[model samples]
Target: MEWAPVCAEGETYANKCMADAAGAQIEYEGECENYFTKEQAQIAAKKWLEEESPTFKFDGIPGSIKYIGYESYTCFGCFGFTFTFNSSHAGYGNRSGQMLAQAIANHTILVQTRGKNVSYALTDGAFDELRQIFICPAISALIPVCGTDNITYPHPCPAMQAGVKIAYEGECQ
Candidate 1:
């Protein structure tokens, strides 16, 4: 909880909308360029500048998010962070359940850095800080992919970032 001081008192939120995936086409305002690997980030940025958009999406490769665009980057860095979007903040409660499912399928995320290596934990509280200040703005700056199969925009939208699989039990009716 390194960024605990920097983050707002409440960072996690519960859905107040729906239990299905989002169907509305929410377009990101700018572009999202992060690298789970340095080389890939470089490559993505280059392509983004030339093409004018980040096309990175999560590949359904266990812990992989897909990156797409009209171009490429010099490098995507090294994988060590789990990326996710906090839907509660996005105000997609009605579409929560479905969005969660789509997120699991896409798995887009960026690599967390530590000085010069991948730390993979929110030690400095970068994630929390981003949640309070950076997340929504970041999403607003990028384009949201239509389907939840790939990681679009800033990636791993807080709504559906990659993380440990949650174990759920059937509700007793």
Candidate 2:
């Protein structure tokens, strides 16, 4: 997510936090004309992870870890990167079954990057904000809605929890 300030003289920042910190009035609904795409962001994140934290493991076996997904947010004035990983299909003893679910639902790998520098936060999640989705109540009625992220959520809570705006009422086409 990139931000361009409301004023013509204002500069564009990588994310919202930078814009806010710089006292730039941002047009939140729109994105800057030029910014790194999701692919670039993911690549940078993966490269940083593999190179800087080669010893990191999700569930005892580093080979079983997978890059599930990622989301970008702002921090101060520098480029901020947060990468979250999860256990793979091959599960081991304690980190398996329901226990695995609970563990993943609660923790994540947070990696931050700035220029050639990288650091680890040691705790976080890809959809930590939407963690409730994992325990959503069994619905007797289904009220699906299409989210601005172009994904269909069973109910508004899932999308809302994930910080996704409702685009329309129904599944995405």
Candidate 3:
């Protein structure tokens, strides 16, 4: 007997494969919600952080974790959430200063605001590097250098290393 595909929303498909391809839950009988709870969001964020850097420690307070809510921007609908807390860097030598170190350790959860889809992955490439930039105290002292992309770098050296052209001195602001 051929089995028909039934989605959580009671939508039927031609076949199980087709329903699966459409991102529908196969043989799922429970109700589905389009929203995620704060707890669920926290778990997703934590899991992503762990996967990214196993040694990284999130030294946030007991109640520091929160769901800052979501906003729509861009094609995939970017949603942002953050958890503020001090991070512990017992093993890795502190590259960024204490203030920047703490900030770097903090968790910034970014996700696509799609229905019931929680991506536990840091999709932003510059996130890690930008966080490091915040840690560099020399950034304030270094002359601002503009790259070919119009991004302001703390120093010309970094701009050159990043393979970007220096437009001018002084911060990119």
lDDT per residue (tens digit) for residues 8-33 in model 2: 11245666677667877674434443
Clashes of each: 62, 0, 2
Model 3 Cα displacement at 49 (Å)? 2.9
Error of 1 at 35 (Å): 18
lDDT of 2 at 79: 41
Off by more than 4 A, model 1: 1-104, 115-134, 138-173
* Candidate 1 weakest lDDT stretch, 10 residues: 4-13
lDDT of 3 by residue, 1-173 (tens): 45654444345566666676788655443333344444554555544443333223334334444455555433222244443323443212123333333333445444433333444223222233213322222445667777878898877657745645566787666
The reply for model 2, stretches above 4 Å from the true place, is 1-36, 57-62, 75-107, 115-119, 123-173
Instruction: Tell me how candidate 3 scores on lDDT.
Output: 0.45
Model 2: residue 158 alpha-carbon error in angstroms: 37
Clashing pairs in 2: none
TM-score each candidate: 0.19, 0.29, 0.34
Error of 2 at 46 (Å): 1.7
Please, what is the whole-model Cα lDDT of each candidate in the order they appear?
0.29, 0.49, 0.45
What shift in Å separates residue 155 of candidate 1 from its native position after superposition? 18
lDDT of 1 at 150: 31
**What is candidate 1's CA lDDT for residue 151?**
29
Clashing pairs in 3: 144-170, 144-171
Question: How much is 49 displaced in model 2, in angstroms?
Answer: 2.1
